[model samples]
Target chain A: MTYRTGTEAFIQGVRTLIPLTPGVIPFGLVTGVMAIEMGMSPGMSMGMTVLFYSGSAQLVALQLLQNGAVPVAVVVTALIINLRFIMYSASLAPYLHHLPRRWTWPVSYMLSDQSYALCAVKFSSGELGRFAPHFYAGTAGAMWLTWQLSVLAGVYLGASIPQTWSLSFAVPLSFLALLVPNIRGAASLGAAVVGGLIAVFAVTLPYNLGLVTASVGGVIAGLLIESIRKKALSNASTNDVEREAQ
Target chain B: MSDLSLWGMFLAVGIGTFVMRLSFVEIYGRWRIPTLLSRALVYVPPSVLASLVLPAVVYPHGQGAFVFDNPQIPAAIVAAWIAWKTRSTVLTLALGMAVLWGVKVIAS
Candidate 1:
């Protein structure tokens, strides 16, 4: 839908994000609860939350910290988890580069998986016109508010809960939820399998280096499978041409 | 584990992450990303996430040993299946937690 004014587009952006909030709220709450449960003071929990502004990275950092991982390892692993943001930044750069530094800086900082997904679709459709950035700000701003408030709620609610609930398992479960949707083809599936197996075998690695190793191995496996598939398709096409000539 | 250390780690990651998010936007015209790197970026999420999920589920207690009978294994499987089918984070988490609790209750 075309918007005559920036406000209309911004409102539309917020509306588009509402449906996705249900998926986000639980993760936010889990991140908050996990942080507090890891013995972080509420003040510190909010500090990390606001600083990182990333649920997956925050959770992974917490998990590594709980495992007695070194600070350097925790930082590396968390940064690795947030690497996908680089891809998002690249994808949205063309659309956002014309904006001022002030707009570009905060907009990039507010980039989340959900906001990227929403904005990518809108930008590609080329419907938002001059207000594309405004629409993005709408979605990103709403998402930011929703995330912080949900996490804040969880922080307050995290205490007084018994330890028997095994709430920590939700961390990995959330990762699994994120993982499944990414496995769309054979290459990605191979990547995940290799990555998972390597992690399990390398669990004994010090400083949580297994995660780094597995991630690299998985990406390499995916590249290998992708090239192999391409070669097979080319070979089959060549065979078809030879038969036609015969 | 001290407050100072924790904040340091947070600052490091925060700065690093922001730089990454701003990388292309800051230099879009000055630099072109390598074609191979762009292609491989698609696999990063799956690889990293699986790497994280598998270990967490297989070795629930972080004992550095995989336990075949870990309740988290089955719970994670069910959750993975639910995630694939529903693609709903809330549902996946709700069912996974419920399954873990149910399995624990039954086993005890």
Candidate 2:
């Protein structure tokens, strides 16, 4: 548990994320394969996998491209879809504050759901020290390497796969897999219903703007419902306390 | 999409995503984010994920564009249930893809 060397922390980080790679490889391959099916050049797809390093946003952009969306819409939708990274950044900021720009920026480039979730817990537990950044970088770098290789294989294999199998269907299927685990709260349900409704009705809009609109609407609905539900629960508790006091 | 436009989209997304990921850590590493923004950020996952997943499941094409009675709808519902029940990404992908291919073959 005492990680003295950066290499030790790095190894520890890589080990921590090993369990999660099973999930990452499939999703990464799917994104790569989908990019090819959706009309992306192999180079662009690979570049995207490298530059963006975000499976969800890359998939969203490819989907938008397939619909002949304008660049603005494609980029905007992808960024919005990736907005969670901001929160991850905020949470990890304190842990990274000690590092200088040269160290922090490169490490920041490696920030991801796995790295953030894993390192955040490590830092919060008051366990890691100066080596936290190296640990995070190690995890991120490992994930990045695995991700790039998977996507390359996927793009190449996706080209050889026959059209009759309809492999492109995996795109939505992967998304369904992502969505199902997240659908727990009233907020999520409300967001899905509202967003789905809007998406269905707004499909005809130019630039694939409907997707962005639905996403924004869904976020609003979820937040609104969540706040209201929380207020109601708090009020109910207060009322019970008042009755007891009386 | 033109090469220029495609590359432009890539640059925009790549830069935007990086900026977002780096922002709090590099730019505002010392700043304390407001409680409200953090709370709202929690809802982003569900909302954006639903927005992305639903249309693909419901339409299976660019909104109202369908050929040969979309099989994805039923497949998605089954996959969704499995996703909720198991919460394993691999399982969900397997079941979802199987159902989709299964529906397509049976319908044909």
Candidate 3:
């Protein structure tokens, strides 16, 4: 499928990002506040905004740091939490592999949730070409700049904002926003529920290993349920075919 | 721990994260991921998210007690409802902050 026009595609990509910004801006703000509370300077926070560019991992790292967890532990937790991005990046490789090395690094830096989603859709529609890279680059690049600016602004405001406000809630709220749309399948829902239950039971684990267990348990349960459901459906279908033959 | 060696640790985590992000694309560029690995990756987001949010909202302090003494629990419930109802991240956040602020005031 051919994209209509280069300019139109870029415009459309930017438009796609508009709806996502509302969720992203508040997350950026929360990250900024958490950074300050965790004893990070604005510069360090800005660095995080530019380098990591992940809301979930950054929030986890902030909490860990605030608790005085060892740096190694903080690093490890952040790594594990963000391990999903590797999948996202790998999935997009076919779309992005054509770009020059100079552009690749920057594109990789801008590969957040919104960018990945938008780029994945665009790439699948056979839109990889000269300006396609720029379309994604512009859209994601715009998001990255806006994210850092929001965080920087929040860091400044964080000093004045009272501790009672609890800007940290913004983090989960952002995730909640994303999670709602993705909960379309029963398997995914079951996984989430079972995962939540396991997490509650294992809340006392140090450095949040409980998170890993909950995640693993939920996935296993969901896979099991899905397998059973698929088997039942296939058996039913087979029975119908046999009845027709008879 | 060591006087918040801000820059040093920042550099370490930043580089580590960047390297990790780049690693998958670099290694798997030529090969497709196996089916089992694909299935496993599917559960990472929700499970990790649930794990992150559950402990914080339910038993935030790492203690074994499961009481709703903290305002985070009620606030999170209210926030989740608003998020589900409106599907508006901005609204969810605004309402959540308001709920948290109200709960904090009452509790304090």
For chain B alone, what TM-score does every candidate structure achieve against the true structure?
0.95, 0.84, 0.71
Top TM-score hit: 1
Each candidate structure's count of clashing pairs: 0, 0, 0
TM-score of each: 0.95, 0.92, 0.86
lDDT of 1 at A238: 51
Cα shift from native, residue A46, model 3 (Å): 1.2
Expressed as tens digits, the lDDT of each residue in A1-246 for candidate 3 is: 334576766666676677777777877787888888776678778877676777777887776676556677677767776776777777777667766778777777677777877777777676555567667876787778778887887898788877656666666666666666555466667777888889888867776567667878887866666566666777465553222111
The residue pairs that clash in candidate 3, if any, are none
lDDT of 2 by residue, A1-246 (tens): 558899999998898888988888888888888888877789988988878888888887777777677778878888887888988998888888678888888888888888887888788776887788788888888888888888998898777777777666677777777766556667777877888788777878777878878877887887787767767877465553222111
B1-108 per-residue lDDT for model 3 (tens digits): 654565556566677767655655566556776766666666667666776677667765544577757887787888888877888878888887788789888887
Fnat for each model: 0.87, 0.71, 0.47
- What's the distance in Å from true for residue A111, model 3? 0.7
Backbone clash pairs for candidate 1 read none
TM-score ranking from best candidate downward: 1, 2, 3
Candidate ranking (lDDT, best to worst):
1, 2, 3
Give each model's whole-structure lDDT. 0.89, 0.78, 0.71
Poorly placed runs, candidate 3 (over 4 Å): A1-12, A127-130, A235-246, B3-9, B24-29, B60-62, B104-108
lDDT of 1 by residue, A1-246 (tens): 678898998899899899999998998899889889999999999999888989989999998888999999999999988988988998889889999999999988889999998999779888888889889988998998899998998898899778999999999999999999988877889999999999999989887889999999999998888777767777465553222111
